[model samples]
Target: MISLKSPRNSAQSNVSPPVKLLGSALIALTVFMLLAPLVAVIPLSFSSEKWFTYPMPGFSLRWYESLFASDQWRGAIANSFIVGTAVTIIATPLGTMAALAISRPETKGRNLLLLLFLSPMVVPVVVTALGFYLFFARFGLANSYTGLIIAHTVIAAPFVVITMLAAFSRFDFRLMRAAASLGASKMTAFRIVMMPLILPSLMASAILAFITSFDEVVIAIFIAGPDQRTIPRQMFTGMREEISPTIIAASVVVIAVVFALMATAELLRRRAAAGLKG
Candidate 1:
């Protein structure tokens, strides 16, 4: 019997520990740089001081209380949830359908279609917002909830399409064929076989779409009316005009919500992977 090691494996084994340590250090530093702002703002949200400051005299929930108590903040929260939910509902089905179409071998102009769907992500957000503003204004959709939802869906659908496309790339088409051979209708096969396999990815995509809508500011600013003010828009207003600790509290709340959504998405991803393996 003869044993052989690949040249790549041998090369990797020869790499020094110091090189790995340097890489690890660099990654840690990058993560710290990204999280630094959140770490600073989170504590400031609990500061007893009325204004933004560090090493507070004492910790207090007064700002959080103020955030909930204020009508503006409450309305913004409501609007954000409304728009985020609406965007998720609208974007998910459209994105999933687009992903399915593009993944099909028989589909024509798949690349072009994908490029169109993902163009929102490539173009500058301000540019996309300006375009939506101008387009919606002509239709009397400016300053309307419908306008805000449509604008958000344009951006968020791409995330769904991309996420599902990745999942679809790994999907086994044989199961759908098996279902079809078993006399299942096209819709029936998709509902029973395809959907179960893709449900986790769908859920993760929906969460991401909702988060995208919730966090979006530029389009919301251009399209949302005073009545449709979202949390991010409200926070922007606070930063420019009020400069209160309540904004910090709102930031903390937003951060918490984002982390929770991300955690859910991660869990769904793991479940999807496990199902595929099973």
Candidate 2:
């Protein structure tokens, strides 16, 4: 018996070792660049020194303890959760509905509508924050939770819309029609037939929207009053007014939360893909 290798395989095998090593080196460099700041910040959060300095004299949990003990930090954390929850609640449904509508073959001006939905993502945050500040002020929403929620929703909704759009791209509309033929109402059909298929995507979008609102700072600064200060806004103020290890601790907590959310989203995404395949 004679063994023969395909030309394509032979060509690929002929690639130089230096090229593979170069590609690996580039990838490692990119990962290091992205993670270097996080690496620095996490250790600094545990440092005992009042100021942010290298070669720490000791490590202590005082900053983390202070974060929990301080009224300002507690209030900011509460406000962040409140606003993030509000934004997710509002944005998720609206985004899913918009995606469903746009996914329909007969929907008119779909491109225009999609562009409008995604405009917030393209526009500069400072510009959007300034606009929200002026608009909310006139409506007596400024310096209120309502104002922050609305502003965050405006920005966060685009993430949900984009995510749902991708999910809807793979959705089978025929199942929805099948449910309708069985005497199900539109809402009932969606809940029973469509929702299960897209639920993971919806959950992921909500998480992303929540993170967007939670981490948002420019809009929070523009619209949030002292009483409505969010964690990011509070951190900004602390950084400007005074330097403390507490901000470092807060950064570590935030980074941890973000990593957890991202991991959850990735799991949901994998499960969604597996479900679709099955």
Candidate 3:
């Protein structure tokens, strides 16, 4: 090793070991915390015993089989998908428009507008649920699919707005003007130039919003009826009624699906960033 007499080099060399140690510790702690519960759940799901007993009670996939066999579980999953998709369809376009408007250089009161857009995220879910219950009851929408969809959209829209705003902040708006000058119409410029640039961010936002609606329980409970029952709402009721390994199995499946979607979104983001740089 070569010794560096420069003060900056000396300071960096002295700091490196401690920084590495701290980073390693943080990574290890995070991994353990995330994986520990998952491991517990997996074993519980496979346990041959009826109850949640640790130790070696043998293992089987009976809980998973039961989960698949149950019509209520299947219906709940379908309901979640319907709710998630509906919320995505509503939130993505509106959020993207809001993000575009707020990101404009000449936009006035942008901070206030952003606050308004993000208020749903800042406010407690229970508060939103309560407010929606009261409002929808007056409108005779309570316990209807429309009410559930609207409630989920309200909660999910802020996530899309925030994600798109982060993506839009680094964009070059002059590109659209250049496209227009190059014989592209206003719509063509937006379609070809802006859409490609923001596509990954939009996808990420949509996926996040979908997952938010999928896992949401508070608003679902307030607005959803038997016909509109979602996976999270069913899971909450099931959890309150009894503790079953089937619940853990269902949770594992949902977690795995969400993890896969998020992983795909992250990969797309990385590719988008690399393409933008190159």
lDDT of each: 0.93, 0.90, 0.87
TM-score of each: 0.94, 0.91, 0.91
Give one digit per residue, the lDDT tens place, for model 2 in 12-57: 7998999979989999999999999988878988888887788888
The TM-score, computed over Cα atoms with residue i paired to residue i, of candidate 1 is: 0.94
lDDT of 1 by residue, 90-194 (tens): 999999999999999989999999999999999999999999999999999999999999999999999999989988888898999999999999999999998
Full candidate order by lDDT, most accurate first: 1, 2, 3
Residue-level lDDT of model 3, residues 1-278, one tens digit each, is 97658987777678877897998999999999999988876778888998888784897899899888999999888999998999999999989988988998688988898999899988998999999999999999998889999988988889889888888877787898899789999889989998888888889899988999998988998999988888878888889998788888888888888898899878867766765554
In model 2, which range of ten residues has the least summed lDDT?
A: 269-278
Cα-lDDT of candidate 2: 0.90
What does each candidate score in C-alpha RMSD? 2.2, 3.7, 3.8
Tell me how far candidate 1 lies from the true structure as C-alpha RMSD in angstroms: 2.2
Candidate no. 3 TM-score? 0.91
Which sections of candidate 3 miss by over 4 Å? 1-15
Could you say which candidate leads in lDDT? 1
- For model 2, the stretches where C-alpha displacement exceeds 4 angstroms are 1-21
Question: Using TM-score as the measure, which candidate wins?
Answer: 1
